[model samples]
Target: MKMRDISESQRQFALLGGIFAAALVVSLIMGWILFPSLAYARKAQPINYNPPLHVEQIGITCDTCHFFYEDGSWAGIPTLETCVDCHSDIIGASPEEEKFVNEYVKKNREVKWALYVKQPECVSFSHSSHVRMAKIACETCHGPQGHSDPKDYLANRITNYSYVVYDPRVPLNAFTIIRDKGETVWGTMRMDECTACHRSRGTSTACFICHK
Candidate 1:
């Protein structure tokens, strides 16, 4: 080809490339801005809670709602004494509260809290894990519960939850994970739910990260 013609062709190609690149960058910017809002429309899998924890009223005292005992041992159960202290006062408050107190507490049995909050049976997820080791706040994933009104607690059903983990040896159903209040009973076991914070915050996860 002639030199002049070759130069013209090269210029045309460069112009086209620049235009393409500009369009690509604009598309990416638009996507980044819009994607998250669209994502909220997508149902969060694995952990599904209903009523969506709105109340701070499940009793904010660490010892009140949480089964973690003062002795550093998980009571894993709330006994009648725990209920009587407040239920005695809450008798006329509401039928639900009274039933929980008068009926269940009077039975000398604890409320059968459907524990959707769980990790793999093989994996020991201590509250101390994030609190002590990683130094991450609980609300990073659990959201704000201390301020959540008890009445607005998202009521979740204690149905089966498929447990997934880093280790294949870990039992799939090792632990029955409890969804927060208002979480759906049947949701997908998503790997992202577990890995989300780790990835976002650049936390290092070894096998001992969750599984011992």
Candidate 2:
């Protein structure tokens, strides 16, 4: 081949490489500016929370609704005084509820609840933010708690799924396949589990999201 032709080929190859590099830079810039939430990360928290087991239930429970509230806010956490307001009059009526109130509540012990949903201390997710500020409701992210009851165990399972959910919006095969749903035995939480919510709707997945 002629020297001029060889030189021309080299120039063409260089031009193509330059174009690719420029395109990559543009894509990164666009993603960082337009979708910062996709790359955000929160810190991790390891806690040992052993919740009360009511009779035969495992992983799912009816006590979620046992939550107490006056106007709209929770009393921080469920308390002994909260249980008797409804159970004192009918302790013997429902042996199960009575047993729980008398055994756990009477001793001034708070139920050891393993909270599935959590946000980093540095990164705060206020209920009011998604509610009043964003004009959304609890059910929007939490699903339908009103229709959920002891009989409806699915919602409770989803609630206690640690940090997993069925995203209806995902395409038929678009699932991220997070954690592979460890089936062999007991397990530990993973960063992917944290990223699931963090990456959702552009929430942060940065170290600061969890590490204060």
Candidate 3:
């Protein structure tokens, strides 16, 4: 009778342990799948800038708006002067353009465009090195920007340590193989993503390579 009771207790313990393990696995799977959406906030753009029209109709390229500095850094946003050079006369007569001209250009103030891809201050990214030396296309990291319609807005969230988002637009190429559902892994300019690319390419994965 004593032996049977002991065996029954052991069996119950084993069953409970198995159930807990299964629950843990399920929780991990669900968290991995659903955490990204829960982690960030998505918002609409204040002003719409059509990339397709500029690229297709007007024959403008990415570099026309987002210029590169001489020192391998990127001038991500175009100055008001750059826009006013052509927009002074209202080429299209669109409301957005008119607003831009009247409100910003005439006022001699720069349009405060929302930045989507913001890197941390401790990191250094060289656009000219990639663009000029690597011969990497801008679309490689920025997605099909030349053809993509202006994004409604960007998603972002504040972490205790930093600001970041998991962008799904990064393409899976030879330079970057890290992917989640055919897109780059949590497409925030995280160290893991950069190190993964460097590791894959046989480049230096030094701590200071990206970090300041």
Regions more than 4 Å wrong, model 3:
1-38, 160-187
Return the TM-score for each candidate structure: 0.46, 0.37, 0.68
**Local accuracy by lDDT, each model:** 0.45, 0.42, 0.63
Which numbered prediction scores highest in lDDT against the true structure? 3
User: What global local distance difference test value does model 3 have?
Assistant: 0.63
Q: How much RMSD separates candidate 1 from the native structure?
A: 13.3
Model 3 lDDT at residue 53:
83
lDDT of 2 by residue, 1-212 (tens): 65455677888999999999999999987765544433322212221112233223344433343433444443333455654564454344556565566656666566554343444334444343344455655444544332322211111222123332233332111022232332211122345654675587576667754556
Better of 1 and 2 by lDDT: 1
Runs of candidate 2 with Cα error greater than 4 angstroms are 1-77, 89-92, 120-122, 150-212
Backbone clash count, each prediction separately = 26, 11, 0
* Shift of residue 97 alpha carbon in model 3, Å: 1.3
Residue 101 miss distance in model 3 (angstroms): 1.3
Top candidate when judged by TM-score against the true structure? 3
| TM-score, cand. 3 | 0.68
Arranged by TM-score with the best first, the candidates are 3, 1, 2
